[model samples]
Target: MTTDCSSVAYFSMEIALDPALPTYSGGLGVLAGDMLRAAADLGVSMVGIALVQRKGYFDQHLDDLGNQSESPTAWEPEKVVEPMLPVVTVRIEGRDVRVRAWRFLIKGLGGHVVPVYLLDTALPENSPWEQKLTDSLYGGDAHYRLCQEMVLGLGGVAILPELGHSLISSYHMNEGHSALLTLGLLEERLEGRALSSATEEDIHAIRAKCVFTTHTPVPAGQDQFPHDLVSRVLGEERTAALEVTGACPAGSLNMTYLALFGSRYINGVAMQHGEVSRGMFPNYPIRAITNGVHAVTWMSPAFGDLFDRHIPEWRHDNLYLRYAIGIGTSEIREAHVQAKRRMVAELKQRTGVQLDEKVLTIGFARRAATYKRADLIFRNLDRLRWIATHCGPIQIVFGGKAHPSDVGGKDLIRRIFESAAALKDVIKVVYIENYDWRVAPLLYAGADLWLNTPQRPQEASGTSGMKAALNGVPSFSVMDGWWVEGCLEGITGWAIGHGPESPDDEVFEIAALYDKLEMIILPMFYGRPTAYAEVMRSAIAINGSFFNTQRMLSQYLANAYFRPAVA
Candidate 1:
């Protein structure tokens, strides 16, 4: 599929494009990076705008005591992205704000230039309040976060005009974080005209040009600032202009509200999430566009090579991606086992994480959020003991960081750490600190089984589990998010959330998940470790065929953007 609208500008508060690019921290960042890569590969003109942090996010370090610590790291613009260019200046509230935006090259990836422009608030012209906008992701106080979102939304909208680009293209808001772009666009339309003089058609047309994609189903996951707080940040003039029917609410500007009202198209990240979103916002119209990963970025050379041979044209056809299954060949299977063995050995030595290469290793990692149920395994201490004592040893390695100021999230991290320390040796738990892309490949390549259990419909689309599957690591996940579509029972991995709609309604969902863990997971690890290893190999082969980013990107092109062009 192709589109006539060749250029697209994607606005997001954060994009986990790559480690070299510190604008993103987790899932949203990964998704943004995937979009950037897809735009390049598909030859779709695209630009990414993100904040330039003087403090390029916090390096979350876990102290020896298992408490999480934060350290600020800054990236040199010249060193971060090659060939730094001229700085662009934009006016924000009667002030000339100088922002340095840079372009990055994704090497080894042969594709069109997908320019990623970052706004640096560290410049001399930036006010202290403006500079504060580039603070850490999911960090600082609530009011501070709103200011940062404004920089991303309003400042980001002004970026294109500053770059000399015409406002004829569509913008994809990754989430509510970039909703301000819509307001900014509306403000541009006003152009000294009185609000009463503006036509409804003009407002609707401005909205039609914007699309909002919501990634979180959980209410708490969504950003909701106090109405009074928004007025404080954006000021009366701008805030009044944004109010519905010209009456500004004392409450914060609902990012979701702005996105919904300002966008002609709104979508959720996964099918379930779409349904959840529709239910969550019954008054608003929204559809689902499931999130996906980038096959090129995720596929390991060893595993990806299989597809290069089976589908020789995949190399040339940037969209051609097979999940990279090494089946019907004993040699390839052995190679996979050896790779897993090597990864485990290295992790065991480096992180001082004790593990049996013979014991089935499970990998669980993500942001330390309570809704994600990072501490699910610990919910059943007795079950853990059973696995440790009677069952062949099973180990789970966890890693991720909480927002610096998220005290609850910090406590969750501490809980996981304590559990890890308690279940030493037999049921070892290694929570790696300072997780970055450099170490991510190791986790994906190393795990025997990738475990994901978010509350049903809570997970948007877990690409981390998908990444593991590409590497031949089977998964055990709740029937939520992308897993609802990805799980191939008794084959790739196990699925939970089967018993009831609510995991809280009946203890059954938890029971089922644990039952599968104890009965299926434990046995595989202990009963016939070698045979289970074969299951891992087969699981990757199966998933690699279907869920690879190539297929996902193609779907988005056909269903979302390109189809409209073809029509």
Candidate 2:
């Protein structure tokens, strides 16, 4: 499929188009995939560029002691994608590194296709070390990561003309990983003119053609390379030019700073994230385009059937999800029960632990990062046992994988297993291993409630809860990320703390979590079936309708993508 140059060229280091692809690490890639799916559904002119991970992100394996280990996740690219001939090359460390591309077409509801071109460095023309650049997703040390970024940013832009996508109107840097694309654009501007003639007008001209989305609130999450390292990798002259233009500060080559300096439009993935980002970079103007999921992709089969019968237009327009409020209470309950039964069977099949279909099932899955506070619920084991044994029979399902280097994150997983052992007799706890896109939908659709407990302001935008909402699963989370916008006290779901400002104290939040579950959530769930179903209906209607990529992509088109091209 050929794309016109007027299409939006979305550049990211990873793209999680499908679970089997393993070209993604976590939320960022998943969000990108969802956006592309929505773009196809809406028929927006678009194309995606990302690195083709050969070995892919590592597969998660746990020892008997619950220590996390990783092995290469293997898959055949030919099974899902076709290779594009005529390799492109980018200068790296004063050497030419040849890059190739693979095409994966994502078909949408109306049969519209969005072509995603994944760039790969593994080729016969490249050296052994150069070939290894694209071997794994988010692998290697700082130097390796920087080179991967170069291939994705600089090389991605260089290949567009060769791939027949040279007429791109706007370049979107999904994150700082692909910020180097700006440098390539800058180089193009300085081609005929003398380097000394480069002015602020030239910088502004390039900035007008690009937009950026910053995903993390944490300081360390952004990439920053040392000056010497950057000088060595990217030639000293080019590095000096970047410094002269104020793209790279004196100390180091801060990727996020470079992206901010180069892009005309900048946005955060959530409302709170937008505010936090602005605070982090007080000098820059940052806007919010909250993250959303592809509704049809995440809706459970049972719910899909239900929606098809009751609200047939939901698949076409997500705003039709608002009609979920008209669905009968019994019908909603039955659909959820069907989804729960399927999940229970799958869980038993995988882990040999039979979960009770009637019991309150809670799901918590995402990257096993420490800021996510995956172990917050297990903070007070005695209180948790009390809630499980005395208040209600509840089961907690955990799914996630920590990065190979994140020891603290792995420790969080180990602690969850330890807590499971301690509370084995009281409540059933199972940590699902190797969580990926295939298993995510089951957990989201099957669970009685979706749980998220991130430290306040740390979460950029948690789309997992939004996916759960699409399946009529109400969230019980802290007042953070999109939850601040989605939560409706007792209507959609319950909040952990009193509100957004309800103190960042862990003990206080945990106590509030227990109090809400024991007092409001459990009573309504066990004693009042009608009330519970109402909450489920509201979750779909209120959260799912608004927190969807249909709206998000439209916002991007209006606010970012379709802005007039630079003169």
Best by TM-score: 2
Predicted candidate 1 versus true structure: per-residue lDDT over 1-567, tens digit per residue = 112223578887777667675677877787788777766776766678777665766788887667888888666766766433456544454456566566564433564666676766766677777666675666788777776777777777766665645544677888888877877777678886765456788787687677778887776666777767666666666666678632233465667777877776677877777888899878667777666667667766766676666655554453333333435445445556665676677677768765666666778878877678888778877777775677666778888888877787899889988887777745778888877676777778677778887766678777888778766778888888888777778777888758225555326666877788777877866676566666666666666555655565566555554333220
Runs of candidate 1 exceeding 4 Å displacement: 1-6, 82-96, 245-250, 314-326, 329-332, 499-506, 525-534, 562-567
lDDT accuracy of residue 381 in candidate 2? 90
User: RMSD in Å for candidate 1, one decimal?
Assistant: 3.6
Give the per-residue Cα lDDT of candidate 2 at 467. Answer: 95
Q: Tens-digit lDDT track for model 2 on 443-544?
A: 999999999999988988899999999989999999999999999988999899856656688888999999988888888889997999999999999999
Task: Candidate 1: give the clashing pairs.
Answer: 15-29, 16-29, 226-252, 227-250, 227-251, 227-252, 228-250, 228-251, 323-544
RMSD of each: 3.6, 1.7
State every prediction's TM-score relative to the real structure: 0.90, 0.98
Top candidate by lDDT? 2
True-vs-predicted CA distance for residue 350, candidate 2, Å: 1.1
Query: Lowest-scoring 10 consecutive residues by lDDT in candidate 1?
Result: 558-567
> Which lDDT value does model 1 have at 422?
76
Q: Cα lDDT of all candidates, in order?
A: 0.70, 0.89
